[model samples]
Target: MRASAKIFWILGVFFLIVAIAYGFVTGTYEPHGIETVGFPAILALSGLGFMIAMALTLAYRKNSINPSDDLDAEVSREAGVQGSFSPYSWAPLWASLGAALCFLGVAAGWWIFAFGIMFAIYGVLSWVLEFSIGQHAH
Candidate 1:
């Protein structure tokens, strides 16, 4: 995690530098179009990366040690069941369908958007409660 954080931080700094350099080269302080906004947008993305790195670093500090941080750690040492995962599910498909409908609504009509929202809600609820009942109850 420490290593990962460092890499992201470096990337963020590199992007920030590029944005500054681009501003100087282009002689533009304000974005008048997409082309002018590219560097700043990249800078924002890099800042997000840096923020993520910081979060990881904080988490690492709390945990103190991880397999990747140990030079002598073997793959087998870290190999184990990490968490429970559903073997099969239809929620993702439903969610995607809803998303597609929502996008379609954007181009077609508001009625489609309403149906999309309802589908999205149903899909999310079913997905979230999948394990609360039926054969997969837990």
Candidate 2:
């Protein structure tokens, strides 16, 4: 986690620098008819993402209970399963279908758009509750 914090800090600062550079470049450059606001905003948003990630990492590090920040501790002391992994599920397929419908709705009509939104919500809810009431759930 310490290593992750360090990495995040470095990346966040790097992106912030790049975003500032982008702002300066866009500010000084001449756009005949092209839009100049979006690119810099995107870059700035990317920097914000990195910065937010860094902040979250730092908060987690501070509140961490185990694995004391000891220099003498060997690296292998932290080896373990990091997270849970589902072996198989149909949730992804449903979610993907919903996303496809959303794309189609953008080109079709508002009725399709509304249906897509409802389908997408159902897919998300289905994914969240997939293991709650299923026979496969433990």
Candidate 3:
């Protein structure tokens, strides 16, 4: 995990540097539209986000109890307490239907990004509702 974090950080820094360079190049030149350079900036920010994810993973790995340790059983019990739902319930159906609707919206030209937002929201809602219902029914 530490190694992965380091790699992510390195990639993030490289991407950030590239993004900065892109800004400079675009700022100095007028060969093409500014929007053409926006993608590189977006890519850089995405790399930075990946770095953040890696950092969080490293932190979690550091704090989590080892499976071979005496605290393993207790840790597992607590983990289970954090989720009392079965994903095998109606969650899959709802999520799949939501995904299909989102896809159709995107295909129909409702806006590509809007479809992504709707899909994400639907995913979260479906998970929450399924978890709640699954736990209660259990």
Candidate 4:
């Protein structure tokens, strides 16, 4: 988790730099009412950085040491199942596709947005109950 946190922090900084560069390139020399690209990029990048800072702060409050982070830890200490993920699930793909459609529908039509909402709902529900109410139940 510490490694992940560091990676996100680096990404956050990189994004912040990119956003600043982008704003400069977009001719934001003086304050304006709004910008099509620069303002949103700055907001999103700063928000992402803030989110990572908050998440890392919260996680560190737990005070748990990661075996992987400990240089002196034994190799055997890391030899265990780490986390579980649904390998055979297609729900994520569907959900992402539905989300993409929803975004696209913003310029397309309300009908497309409605369909995307239904698709997203179905995908999310299937993902949640895939193991609880199916052959995969354990």
Give each model a TM-score: 0.77, 0.67, 0.52, 0.66
Position 99, candidate 1: lDDT: 84
Give each model's whole-structure lDDT.
Answer: 0.83, 0.71, 0.63, 0.78
Cα lDDT tens digits for candidate 3, 66-127: 33334335545445354454645665565666677768776776675466556667676867
Candidates 2 and 4, the one with greater lDDT? 4
**Global Cα RMSD, each model:** 3.0, 3.8, 6.5, 3.6
Q: Identify the runs in model 3 with alpha carbons over 4 angstroms from their true place.
A: 31-33, 36-47, 50-54, 57-87, 106-123, 135-138
Kindly list the per-residue Cα lDDT of model 4 for residues 3-45, writing each as its tens digit: 7677778777878887777767665555663457666867697
| Tens digit per residue, CA lDDT, model 2, 1-138 | 555666767777777777777666766774743237765675666677687677768677678634645667777878899886555777777777878888888898767777777777887887787777675565
Q: Between the candidate structures 3 and 4, which one is better when assessed by lDDT? A: 4
In model 3, what is the error at residue 104, expressed in angstroms?
Answer: 3.1
Worst 10 residues of 3 by lDDT: 66-75
Q: Which candidate achieves the best TM-score against the true structure?
A: 1
Q: How accurate is candidate 3 locally (lDDT)?
A: 0.63
* Candidate 1: worst-modelled 10 consecutive residues by lDDT: 27-36
Candidate 1 steric clashes? 0
Pairs that collide, model 1: none
